[model samples]
Target: MTLVAYAGNLNNRANVWVSLLAEERRRRAVRAVAEQDHAAVWELVEAFMAFRSQSGVLTSVHTLRSYRTGVRQFLEYAAEHAVNVLRPGRDDAQRYINALVAGGKKVLTVRSRVAAAVTLYKALRWAEATEANPFEETFAPQDRMHALEKVPPYQERVVRRVLAAAQERIAQAQPDELDRATAVHTLLVVLAHGGLRIDEALNLEWKDIRLEDDELRLVVRSGKGRKSREVPLSRSAVEALRAYRALPRTRKHPPRKVFPFASRSSAMYHVRPLFDEHGVTDWRGFHALRKYMGSRLYENLEDFAAVAEVLGHANVNTTKAYVRVGNERARKVLRDW
Candidate 1:
């Protein structure tokens, strides 16, 4: 919302072409179509973007950019199919799906594209079969989906290597000697053991941690879906955190957010290098560390329900995917027989 407001406010007015800037901005919000069709598609796309914005999903400018790309493609599809009509041919729907696959996109990536199209479909749904309801026909079949590229399961050995490697990296680093290293490693444990999203991990405050207890649990104030939950702490995690807290805090510093960086980007700059040095592939993303962490917990505990609780997932199903056990593990047990 802040970014949206800032982008909205950019103008020279008497000295600059404010209206032209606004026109260009609006055009960016939708994908291109024929000159005659662009207006309608843009109008619909803007309304959808505005709705997501109001709901807070479109909070960041980069997020708006992603939405722009998705919605633009949707507009083209809608226009090509003449979605204004009550019934679009089934062929129209398949062609669009084929086009996405033809671009060499994975099923999951294409799923995101279809999801955006579905969102538009729902937002625009009336007494209409426009675009032959493309979403329904494409994703309803399990085999077709199975044939689409799926993320390969993270093998047990790889998952263990990742976690053990993280610990080794932390052991090798002298936190007191390196504040940036210390901060990044400490936060990684929070994501791994505390079952926190990267954003929530980054957003932690001093009050969120309960260190005095024999166990450590973090109170995540804002999480996905804007819901909150408490994540359990491990013994190693408690000790590391206690050590981190004993470090300096400025009088001018904010009460919350224990690891507030100069900015989110600066934190990433520090974290990325550490991941590169440590041989962990997650420097590019906090969620990858998150994925392995969940896997480690699930393998050890063999309890998806508990993992879900720690991860603050409303549904255990989501947690299961994060730390999913594979058929290979099941085969090992069967082989023992």
Candidate 2:
């Protein structure tokens, strides 16, 4: 029976109808797998994502986008190589990984794509859509370097230079360009001080800013893993924000969001030139600012747990990766030895 007709007949039991619809989709997916229908299998992937969204298993749009990209890449590879994704042989996953490696994808990128495939198969199994688990035994190649070794935090001097460049742009901006300049500067200040993820900062509404007597804090309503935390703003950050808010353009009709850039890329377009002008060529973009904040906070507080709290890191170990040890400190310890 058509889903529409079935739903129409079960108007009284809407919940049951929904459940039946999901089961029907699962059955169709199973049939598609058995028939080796690539197009139908792609539809099943979409259905799996929809199911996760409906079930609140996936809350972040960024996460959904990443999963879609990774899964789509895998499916594309499978189709090109004439492999049935749902009925892959034992070596299919390894072959896919080998292809990615052959294409010179970074170790981290390869691992993330593999993880996305693994997640998709696990969800499909839970929904009874397919019994195939091609990626169950497959593993991505391990990176020889640790996270800290990969990208060190931006130095304090470099950060200061970038911030100064931003301030100069704000000062020299034309009347028509004043708002954009001020907004970018404020964003940089927040990133430098708040240690927030770029998404978290971009998503901030004016309501998230909490200002008390001589102090300022930002409320991140939805962070990684759908968690929420408050990060206290530094004195300089507070001043920058206040200055931005007091601008005639901002005061006339303040935007609902703190930074009114359309997307993350749009925001980066304004800030990236400043970074390039300065020698911060890590390519991590705004994240380097976050790492700078984490490292500075750890240096001052000397408390891993406290730094983790400020950075909204779930684990202290993750926070440690963000904090960089200075060469001078290492030299001092070695000299003592």
Candidate 3:
């Protein structure tokens, strides 16, 4: 299925995905598929995979890969049961879900797998390979409200120790790795202090950073849903970015991208080891930093709107989770009682 032809069926979502892939990759994908039965299915799958590989724009790359993997597993299972993935009925979808649940997969895993199946079936429906999305009618878990999973922010001491260690690592970098070290160090500061998502940091451009008259602002040009917002930079975060920008390699010919890392995951490639070195095993990755930022902003300022604006949370409900009382603080108070 040619991209133009596929785009006609996919509504706007396919067009967005296609634009994210380079022209060469999009054309290559269109030409790569062989003429066969269910060729459209393969073409759509290839297109989705290509989009997953190249663009972490709309969703995290890790999530895209996981969804693709789940979809492929369902395809294999369908082949064994003589079910046509392109034309699955509700019963066929239910059986697959039952198989997953029977195998003792967690509710979240089962829901993710079913969601992947629904995504593919939607593509098939667009391709006119099926009359409807079979997986749409299938039962799946609905207990995934993020509020229930909320926890207290990391202890203030641990937060300080992690940021301090990041700076120490940058100071210790070898000559050849100075730029890389600066990049990681800047990311640590921005993520923890600025509260930006991993992708937002990775997608930041030189044009988005404004350092005028000693005031610093980072504009997120393309946040979730392509929304744009400008966040004030913490003084320390600004200092860290300045130090990174001043590196010899950076000054020589600044890359269009502000961060040196290629992708979101690659940006944090060094973070795991750093966390381990700091003896902080329980620390969640970037989200923990964001939560800490959100919590502090609310606790200090007592402004829901301000916290929401800075964190880029579309709903105040999401913002409210960050303000929940810290576990360590609660323990300390109870220790005296």
Candidate 4:
């Protein structure tokens, strides 16, 4: 389909702006290409990314940022080695893979960068800017590490320590610092109990939470890939949230958001020290908590589908990575045997 046709189908106000922006970027790229400008390659990359954005194929800011960085690295390598960005050969792709391996990049990192390069070629093909995709047959090295070894879930004891630390902070907080202390503690509680992504938890509003039949539940309006789902809150999570809500509001009219922090970094700023202090060093912030919830659910339910539903994973395969066999479970099984 033509770029105009692809963009024309969008009717929403936000998408209309995206379409216009993509069109402008495409025009600039086309002009640069016609003028034989060296900068045409970069313009084309921007236009391609804009097209992806307008098409709704790439929505996550983090993914877009990572892809841009990967693509830029590849472009720099191509320029240095006299490889044509517009029509790179398979040999060039292999050389790039070799360079990445030689640079001591992790297997996953190499794969991610290669995937980014492949996606860039796909964009170029969609834009009709290129007919070749050198990355089509290229492959990154295999990951030899076991799945559990890659990202192990936090043990129950460690999770308890983290929660205890948060609770202690709340208890010890002075009158003026109570609001922030409570918010941080509750944020961690929701992540641990609800199994929600950090972004999902951060985006939650007061309206999204519901109390039915004395059970607390959360409505995730938009999750990864724009999917929505309902998550049942654990008793501990509910209690923490209830305590947070009961705190006296400093402002007569406060924001409807569950947490007071605006950005992920802000949330982390309050909780990272707690996490580090309590032995959560390897995994990314907040995600380890989600994995902890997932592991516990799987251990109790023994059903992948049920755990997947709670975790809002569309594919059970993705859920598998989140569920780990805890030491306690292993010990129980051995003791029974």
Candidate 5:
């Protein structure tokens, strides 16, 4: 199959996967072109992988996988242009980024691609080649971030209804599938109530649970920047987890992750399909949970600082976006009003 044609599905975007795969093979020659340092790229990635493994801080496998795609694309583009990758001067990096933007890539795409490039550059210490790391001179944030186009708040009912249907399917499945269903349900609760990204939800472990003053708390070990943060478990979340723990577990091993069967992949692997199966059209993925959590939390709390703590955000500015509480359904709101 042609490279793009081979990557056939939403699950992995086959074209990107195939391209990254080819890049992995080509990386050796890209680095140290004069010396044919074929393994230079691999060595760089492996160094990050090893650091992540040993330091227990630098790498989450989910993030590492993304770097694979981003850096591979950079190397692939460099190879096509006949640029000696291992020795790409700083201007070359600038051109590579500009070329991507010039080729009709959206701002988010451009930013993500640049971020990916930055990761590889940092991984191999490529940034030091520039007196100031030309990438550091990014004078402004990408348009995607500054321009806020949230899914309309009215859509919460759409998402919640869809989730409710997904719950019914879970409740009716056979015993074997029921375990998976229960796992799915538990994950849903984490998304719905705990406001966790799917990977954060999947990587959750029993040991992270701390009950203090009768309130349940969750400590997420793998987060952006590997910053460990705490999330308060709502009563529904607490009860769902308790019931989930009561359910039969697959791993005989103690203190492993919550969703043992889940792997390090995109969060959509869990959330997106539910919409397809239930026919909830145009639905986004797990980040909706953050929105749901943020909107709901604002009803009870006013300060973004508290919301930031609740959502595990490093920056209060990020938490501000989440705290905008839209008016709820008229019936729900007018129960006494």
Candidate 6:
């Protein structure tokens, strides 16, 4: 489907008088709607955009742009399929969703577009502009849950095996290569124990780590949404890091950062293979470490807010998606019952 055609066409209207600087930034949404072919749907889009602006719902310029782009695409799909935007049926909505998924759009993208469609309809409905709400019924009960989008947490056994491999590799390295081995070992431990995103781990400087007499912590400087939080470090991870820092390679030229690795790709070069060799499936990248941390923290602390805070998630529901209950725990709960 030509997703950009509707926006592109709308953006090129001869009568519209937008500044070149504004048009150059790909401002597809805020343009004046001069298209009379689909005036009915266009009117609804205008009303919805106005409503979003007035209700303070569109917090960011990005969100407003997304809603505009997505709604226009939906209208284009509706016009082509001979479906009424104001009174759409279940089949009409499903077809649009299916087309988006089949056309290789990410699930989240399709879902977000559908949500934009829903917001438009709701605004129209509230204004007595439409009688039906198709987008609401189009998504299944299960589809509304973001669980499928979540990264599957790493199995405890798999995590243990990966750590074991790192230790084994450290032991097998020659004396002259001990520093590299120590760095790799420490890297894996920091990820597994601290539950840091690979980028967060890569950004770690010596100053971020606090190896206090009674406690250890790593201050996450750059978290999701640029939020920062302090995460407790495991004893094993702290010790591994200590060993890595003491090595001749590290001591001779102390790193500006805690981990010797420079980039996420470079760190992954040393880290991913450990799991790859063990035939790990569903490789969720370093984010899985954060998921594992979320799950473990929830299990131990029984606090969603606390887990959300540590992971630097603004929403607790997002944290819920990150944490996964283990199969063993599920089976045990059932068996005891």
lDDT of 2 at 275: 79
Q: Which prediction has the highest TM-score against the true structure?
A: 2
Which stretches of candidate 5 lie above 4 Å from their native place? Answer: 1-39, 45-57, 86-91, 119-141, 144-154, 210-213, 250-255, 264-267, 326-337
Instruction: TM-score each candidate.
Output: 0.63, 0.84, 0.77, 0.80, 0.72, 0.59
Which is superior by lDDT, 1 or 4? 4
- Score each candidate by Cα lDDT: 0.59, 0.76, 0.71, 0.76, 0.63, 0.69
lDDT of 5 by residue, 274-306 (tens): 777776776655676667777677677767788
User: Candidate 2 on 160-231: residue-level lDDT in tens?
Assistant: 888899999989999878988898888988988899988998888878887675547889986887778989
Ranking by lDDT: 2, 4, 3, 6, 5, 1
Instruction: Give candidate 1's whole-model lDDT.
Output: 0.59
lDDT tens per residue, model 3, 75-130 = 77877787755445659989999999898887888988987777666554443445
Which clashing pairs does model 5 show?
A: 7-14, 7-15, 28-38, 29-38
Q: After superposition, how far is residue 326 of candidate 5 from its true place, in Å?
A: 7.5
**Candidate 1 lDDT over residue span 1-337, tens digit each:** 3432233321211112123354453453232233435445434444444443354333443344455566678666667667532345666656677788887876666766666666555434421213335567664212343211233333445444544655566567664544444566677667656767767777788888898776468788867766788878888678778866776654234646677564556667766665466565634365665666677787788888888877778898777666646765988899989
Cα error, residue 5 of model 2, in Å, equals 15
Candidate 6 lDDT by residue in tens digits, 6-104: 323323321132222433312232222223233444444544454444434223334556776777888788767888665677688888888888888
Write down the TM-score for model 1: 0.63
**Candidate 4: tens digits of C-alpha lDDT, residues 1-337:** 6444333322332243335555564555445444545345443454455556543543565665677777778777877788876667669998999999999999998988897788767666655556778977776799988655676667788778888999999899999888888888899889888999888888898898975556579999868878889999888888888888888877333468888776788888998898788676754667778888998899889999999999999999888877766666789889988
Model 6: which residue pairs collide? Answer: none
User: Model 5 residue 62 lDDT?
Assistant: 59
Lowest summed-lDDT stretch of 10 residues in model 1?
9-18
Give the worst 10-residue stretch by lDDT in candidate 3.
29-38
Off by over 4 Å in 3: 1-42, 45-66, 102-109, 144-152, 250-254, 326-337
Clashes of 5: 4
